[model samples]
Target: MDDQNNFGAQSTLSMPAESIPVESIPIESIPVESMPFESMFIKSIPIDLTSTPATNWDNQSQLILSFESMPIESIPVDLTCAPTTISDEGVKLQFDPKVIEKKYIEERDKRLRDDGIDQYVRLDQERQSDLYAGSPSPRDPIKKEVDFLIMGGGWGGLLIAVRLIQMGITNIKIVEKAGDFGGVWYWNRYPGAACDTESYIYMPLLEEMGYIPVEKYAKSPELRKHARAIGTKFGLYDKALFQTELLALDWDEESKRWAGTTNRNDNIRAKFVATASGPLHNAKVPRIPGLETFKGHSFHTNRWDYAYTGGDTLGNLDKISDKRIGIIGTGATSVQAIPHLAAGAKHLYVFQRTPSSVDVRNNQPTDPKWVDSLTPGWQKRRMENFNTIVTGGHADEDLVGDNWTDIIRKLSVLGGKNQSTASADNAAARQLADFQKMDEIRARIDNTVLDPATAEKLKPWYNQFCKRPCFHDTYLPAFNNPNVTLVDTDGQGVEKITEEGIVAGGKTYELDCIIYATGFEFVVNHTNKSSLTIRGREGLELSEKWKSGASTLHGLHSRGFPNLFIVSLMQSGLTPNLTHMLDEQAIHIAYIASYCVENGIEAVEATAEAENKWVQTVVELARLQQEFTKQCTPGYYNNEGKVSDVVLRNSWYGLGSPAFIELLRKWRKEGKLDGLAYETAH
Candidate 1:
């Protein structure tokens, strides 16, 4: 057992920072409740930390250290603390100098490691594999030109390809690294892999594809199958280059074409290149010392090794009945997978660094009646409704996120709304009050956890809106099981790993197997580091332009790279419902593609001024949502290690998705598409 000082250093606390200089909108005026669940990213903190008097650590393994539950209001605004003494049942707890000494040492070590300057796998550092560095041009002796070359065979890419086909752009090819379609869906086949977002709204083109999800959150197999179905539906299955990784892409000014080479040794040229390689494509492993040296059978959660587990995608892990297993990480992926691992492994030890705040996930099979009720245009309306309420925009009706609506109702009770039916006005006010309800939800978490120390640690100190809010009914209760143990590593992560198990808190854990659910890399690294070089107009490498940060009119087209589009969650749009955003992007790309071919235009790129205006818009929007910077948990949203409130601003368009789509539509209709310059085919 790790040494625990019932009393040592005082708890450090701080109020949510005031990053966005914008004035706050009152919640009392809005009629609808802003869903605290939707604002799950936002973090809140209380004032004043009263230091517990230092106590002697004797051989008291069973000693339960509990602090008095402070009220949400009573918590100090400035995070100040004073020491206190305690004498409980003949055990004299004395405030000692040793405790402070230990805390000082611990804090210093923590600062050195978690500073986000992870030297391991540093992209800037020198590497043996020049694969990351730039390589010589590997274009074919004779270019094989095509109408369109779509990168990534994921849902988004497939959709864009389908639309292009409809517009009579037949000569199109898709290059994918995976052996087949599905992109992320194909790769992540862990036992409990499923969509947390409601399947009805989350799954795209369901009615058109004539597909029905078995559960509200479709499982990995089903999701993968859906991807295949999309490819088949669009007739893109034949022209795709599977198991091929794009090596480099160089724009040939002489030919007015992009010469692209891939790992499969195929050199191809295309008039237009659409990069739909979605986020979460790359699997990130922790740089824990001795990770690779461990002589054991291991694989990432994304590449679920079913042969070792004795279960398929649907979770019947009867194979590992006698094996002792340990899984690292308590994030969303692990939350879903652990239950099955528990059932199979004789002794399952979960190595946790940071615990996730899991809300209720009332998952159920898709209702036939609900599906029947959803007609044409219902998806669009429902999607729009969800976007408006979640993003603090005025909506006709609050739909999709029921938890958000429930919180809004509570806010309305606290402060009355304009009407009982539906109120679209004062959405900003409604959202603010909804945050109040979230404060209550945080309290509810304290009430549930049996251990007070555990409860406090479990309680997320930052705003709930910072990280993706996870929903699971089974996750919390799973910890309550006698077979499972909650190893709370007070922010100081796992000490090290030994051949036996893991060395945490100076105690070694003996285990048969270890699992890592660490998650994906979020920071956008250029393809130049991956040996995929792209030279645009005047042979200026795209990498050189984006060295400081990304530059694009709408996170789609950069100024130099004409006829090239990116279809990911950049500043152009960010949404909980990824499919909706993908649909919007696909539509925009299709219009541009058709516009180019129909008008005999060879190339089109965003103008420098348009890119500048869009960047300004992203900065302005980020300045409005202070919650993203303030009160948010220390994660990718805010600079993970730094205490500052500045976050990496993203988005293509200045406004939200609905407004963005409308703008794109208007631009297409206007025929000018003012922000772009096109070169006609000679």
Candidate 2:
């Protein structure tokens, strides 16, 4: 258990900083009822966290920590423009520190389960109503074998396949649940779907694919096309089984390989397996009351019925021009797709619970002259440089001058850029710096949104990193359209879905169609993503072993699952640019697999000692982030304000993405494979 997270974890009562510049936070218009905290807080007092005795622990473990609920207005932060003082260090914001609740998670059959997604997945599958309506993979079942079996044909698996082939290991096969390669791109066909991360850094192996993105932010179709191009280039098409779902992956001691059973009758056997099944593959529709009773058309944004919508991903939704549309979410997907829906729907009702932090996305075409001027290794250098700067490291220059880099630049300045060295480690100073960034973000919303009421309603009250910050210039302006109506739920979600429309905040919004922009479940169980089980040595289910928490060394190898790698960002370097992270992991996996093949090793797995060391290191680094997350408003980043047991697990490498990649590169260069234990087939 985290010492800081325990109940009554305070020790000393003091001030934030002596003689610090005081800024009075204006709270004139903010509704008192909308805030989170209640009568639980005491008056002014700041605790010197370091003075707390280490042995004094909070042993209480429960789901919802009881709180003394109070009105936001009753909270003691001075609303008037009073100069904040050293005595005002007890300026605790909205959230009640005592009310850390456990999120919705269930442990089953010895593995962590995504309880939130079970109903959503079932409803989505039934809505399609076609057993075989997904991707047209193999109609017939057959048995096959290979040297390596990769799960999910998304960027991670494709990159691994490409790297393996490049290493002269053409015996690998990629088994994707979807009948395609793009992973999230293939699954999410919602209108206005595009990456928030810059295309140059987000798109991996650009030099290898010999392709350049057309614009700063690449859309879904282009990304999907890029996936296919990579598959073609690496000859993964012939070796891949599309629309195939694995039932279980078991070790076959006799054959010295893994026996993978699937939904199809075909059983696969491979020397190695990579569970790269990404989180975005599983489509989840919100389980609202009377959701199915609606007589009009409705579908998840992911499985977008383009035929009914009368447009492709780029959106010309002519058929829906006469229809009344209602979108249920206001997240990243909704921010992009709503504008397109507004263009088509005669009347569009955007039922929003909480407003997303929408930042500026100054998207533009890549300059052809600038592109031509780049040298051979410019792309790699640019990607590395961006990653370094974004993670608080000093970079020679800022290549991508978008919102991401801009925020980091500002943060760098606050972190003692005035003093030669960047001292971002100080928690007090970091929190102050974050305040500056959020202020700038709120100011941006004020500038873009025309209506003061709508702008204030849309301004996110939380920290910038609290939610996945959305970026789009068109989203806010769409509200200005005569047809678009912003139905703010005021924190409470839609009360219920009636047959005609949605009832929220005591208002009935009748509509012809309801579009579910609720996104997929991210940072979830592997079984949930793959919709399959993995049985390692001695019939031990993968879920059972990780029931306590994720166990991995550098997010790659697990102790029992020899020759098996968990590919996504779990227990590894987590960067916003996912493709870049995947490629680095792919390269490392390739080098290690090559080494095993050359050395005649039957299986290689992480030792208990190695896994423990890695976990400890990651947990230590995670401490810094835990405090930061507590200050932000509840979102998936902080498990919706409920830091459950699973929430405490270290999901990523504490070090930055670039540093983690360099560590792997260094390990491979050393050529010893130090942390792994090799077992030959009996």
Give the whole-model CA lDDT for all candidates, comma-separated: 0.58, 0.66
Best by lDDT: 2
**Candidate 1 structure quality by residue, lDDT tens digits, 1-682:** 0000000000011111121111222222211111222222212111111221112111211111111222222211111222221122111112222242243235333433455524223222221112211343344333467878888887778878877887788899888877678867777777777877666667778877877788766777777788888888777888887766787788887677888888767888998898877766555556676665555566677666777888876689987878777787777788788878876777777777666656667878777887787768877788766665544445556667555333333444332233122212222223323344444445656766566665655554333444555666666656555566666566666677776777777887776677777666555544533446788888888777876666777778889898889665555665567777788788888888888888888889988887776666555444433443333444444434432322334422323445555556666677876788888988
**Any residue pairs clashing in model 2, and if so which?**
14-46, 38-70, 110-544, 572-653
Per-residue lDDT tens digits of candidate 2, residues 1-682?
0000001111111112221111111222111111111100121011122443322222211111112332434333333434432222333233222222211011011122244224343335655332224546346786888889998888889999999989988898788777678877777777888888888888878988888999989888888899899888888899988877777899876667899888777788999999887646555665677777888888877777777778878988999988999998898889989999999989999988668877788989989998898789877888877776666555677988778777766644542222121112222233334444555666777887788887877766654555666778899989888899888876556778888889998888898988887666654666666567888888888888877667888888888888998886566776666777788989989988888898888899998888877776555444434544444454455554544446546356544565567777777777888789997544
Clashes per candidate, residues 3 or more apart or on different chains: 25, 4
For model 1, give the 10-residue run with minimal summed lDDT.
1-10
User: Largest TM-score belongs to which candidate?
Assistant: 2
Distance (Å) between predicted and true CA of 565, model 1? 0.3
In angstroms, give how far residue 395 of model 2 lies from its true place. Answer: 0.8
Candidate 2: regions farther than 4 A off = 1-123, 128-139, 418-429
